[model samples]
Target: MVSTALQPVTLSEFMQLHNIEESPAWELLNGQVLQKPMPTFYHSLLQKYLVRAIDNANSVYEAFPELRCILSQNSVVPDITIIHHSRIPLGNQPIQGAPDWIIEILSIDQSVTKLISKIQACLAEGTQLGWLIDIQEEVIMVFVPNQPLLLARADMALTVLDEIALQLTPNQVFGWLKR
Candidate 1:
């Protein structure tokens, strides 16, 4: 469901209402609370596979699932975030910075234009790469500087960080939900 509010609030005020068991996912984008749907089974599985594969390839990546990215006065919890291991926050709060990689799994409620805008925001904030995975179309949209590539099938493997030797077949990822 979309937010019913006509006015925006401060990011600090937004964080104060944080609860892990909340119904929908909420983020402070431009200091306004943005709510999106919770993950379905397929979405959740892909998230896990990405994390596990990354962890297996290199133990040094600081990967967090649903970890909030704290900005100047707002917070955004990307679906999955991959940062350098040295930058992991030790406390109860999320860190500020465009994570090296931010992955967003699409939901039916979000518009394509809106998602692109969000990816652009990440790029402006210093994110090296942003991925928008479309489950329905079975394609992955990758945003890199000066280029945007769409991978329609798992056979077309994807690579975000070059240092890590990880490969994911789209079919393998989607197949996990069948069982």
Candidate 2:
């Protein structure tokens, strides 16, 4: 993530700037603009597999990639956003609140601290689950409401929304890259 030194802009102004055709996605963190890094091969693959796994798990929730979520004064485009079917925003408008689940795959050279801060921001705004997948380390940092940070590796089963009937592990997630 590259932070811009420009003066802070309101969310509405940021939205206008973000809608330019063919422009790279931008995030508003604490009223500052930050350019998201382009995803690497592994980052892209992990996002695809995770979305597929979550979407296939059940109909109660759906996972979307690169969806912009407007949370209060901050707006973020999480790598993957999972929303309960009933809570899905009704129109062409971007999601107005934090998603039920937010997943971010760490890109090469991206700041892990910033990513974790993003996840924590979402968690503070009602997100039930958050994950930061570290492809190189083959581990996942899990975030849940009111709980300490948890790390999952190898065959450790990952936690998911209670309504979703899928079981996953870091090993299984990384295995997708083998194909």
Taking the tens digit of each residue's C-alpha lDDT, what string does model 1 give over 17-39?
74622656677666456776777
Looking at candidate 1, the ten consecutive residues that score lowest on lDDT are 18-27
For model 1, which pairs clash? 154-170
Best by TM-score: 2
Off by over 4 Å in 2: 18-23
- Tell me the deviation in Å of residue 168 in model 1: 2.0
Report lDDT per candidate: 0.74, 0.87
